[model samples]
Target: MRARTWRRIPPAARRLLAAASAVAAMALLAACGSDGDSASGGTAAVEPVTVGLASGGSRQDGSWTQAWYEGSQTAQAELGDTVKVTFVDETNSVDAYDKSAASFLSGGGDTWIFATAEVPQLVDKFAKQFPDSMVCGVEAPRESYAANICTLLPRFEQGTFLAGFLAGSMSETGHVGVVGAFDFPILTAELEGFVLGARYANPDIKISRTYIQSFSDPAKGRAAALAQMSQGADILFSGVDQATQGIYQAARTAPGTYVIPQYFDSWEQAPDVVLTSVIYNLQGVSQEMIRLAASGELANQHYEFDLKNDGVGKLAPFHELDSQVSDDVKSRLAEVEAQVISGEILVPGPDVLGTTGAGSKLDLATIKAE
Candidate 1:
């Protein structure tokens, strides 16, 4: 599978939007028909390539799973008729992941896309069970996984740092809030980075964090956002997945409040309220993995996509706030990008900060959030 030029469209954001329903509908039974010629131009037939993704959630969920599903679509298009993409949704649960992978592999689908963190838990077991199959985990670094099970994720904190900078710079109240779902190490990294950048921009920046624990509970997310807002937060960053939409809903009632979205370019969600988003190239990452898998070189690799590799996208365009952002701010963000890529700036992650806490179950200032 390879990537190509394609029009960028707004995401379906899980239950938050209806447009994504079609993406899931089309994907559930999506089949790629060959154009009768190999992309390689060989007179011989192209070998059949089947890629299966045991997604943790529905493709409609606008964040993690949607990115994987989009990759499937790209692979289908780029790989042409020689490839068939199969999807098994609702793989969040360990039982579901085990059962779904078993079912997909039993049907002779060997190359698999493990889009859930739970999939890593099944990697060694599944690799032994299926032996010849490749299990690729998303959402974290898989560099430490078993040889047969690989992983890939972006340095999400790099982008989160930029968001925090923008939030801190633009906040009239010098206070911002982050509404996060379940706390993963990556989420912790994002939180820590956000505060780091905010403080760099405004040393007096006060940070508040609220965790709702569940990724699907909008009411809880709204409550969390409101809690932070009541404490005087003017800028909000969401670390939660689809449930983050609820924070957007909460922001709607608060006039002059700004929002920063992650994972996707969600400007269409709130063009006026958005500061910008920390974007990811999910399609690109998926395509590269498939390409490697097709060539039998995907094992024992921990792939990371970030600002330097174009695997991660920087701050999205500030649509309605175009004029509001000073040119100086833009230039500083570019400098941050350069410094991060050049290793001149080392963003402190949870590993460096040494914290194992998360969600409402953990301590608030564990990550040095003020």
Candidate 2:
């Protein structure tokens, strides 16, 4: 659950040259165990397998990094002494992240998780350099098929669509808005999905979208939310990080307004106005990756966590706001979820939605489910 300062090992001449198979490595570990007593029967020691994680953000970011931190703890709890999870946080720069990874490898760590975006290249680079070790890149743009590489892309749009549908159904002003952090492709896809879902639920609904260009600036997020609220948006969705607090704050002042946040369950932050959350389930996904690596069955390909996987792209419980959502709304939400998971409703990815925003030209008729 926590990252510690690991003793640095010089990487110049200490790099592991020979690649070892997982089976061979396991056998070597067993052989290194303390010998059993001859006079009295004694069990061989259980050699702990160490796994390292490198993240660009702090472990307590209350968002992405925090989820992975909890996941590591969960994996360790489940695997017990058989697996050891250690992490190095605040590796924000490329050089820092690479150095941390190299240090981990130099210290005999076979499996390392790169927890952030734009890491598929590094995953492939490290995987090729250390074929014996399993390398995982979280939130990677694409799949890496190298023998020991694991790339991940969580289908967050699915969950966002569900939340947007809820907002569309519940909005009294016939308008909903999204306050996004940036206009990146992934975030754009999520924002577009919300728009599509809202329109699906209520074709007459109006959407107001804004990009604050900052993830940690609460003032900017609040200002965007307030501006949308002034334009008669009764329900709002947040695609920002700590800035989401601003949306929550704005919701508090405007009675009957609701907010939906992404990444993790944030109902506790504003229980009064939080309708629900679009969760990526980073904790669950991370735990699965660690388990696979530990068992030596991790595949070399891109991993997608979607509605069908039951790994990510799910909505959190509606806690205190449960009574506000009608049974009909809940039923429709469930039906749409099944359709998306079954491929009947093919939610478009970012690539499919080119430069989307409020009032953007769209052929809604062409987006129907097959």
The residue pairs found clashing in candidate 2 are none
lDDT for every model?
Answer: 0.72, 0.79
Candidate 2 ranges with C-alpha deviation above 4 Å: 1-47, 92-96, 118-121, 128-131, 139-144, 353-369
Which 10 residues in a row give candidate 1 its minimum summed lDDT? 1-10
lDDT per residue, candidate 1, 1-370, as tens digits?
A: 1222122323434334455677776666453323333444566676666778877767877676777678778877787776777877767678888888888877777587776544456766777777667776765553365556777766777777778878878888889988776666666767767767777678777889877887778899888888889899999988777777788888888887888878778888768777788877776777777767766667766777777786474788898888888898888877767776676766654454213322222232343433
TM-scores for every candidate against the unseen true structure: 0.79, 0.79
Q: Which residue pairs of candidate 1 clash?
A: 14-60, 14-62, 34-81, 207-370
Best by lDDT: 2
Candidate 1 Cα deviation (angstroms), residue 131 = 1.1
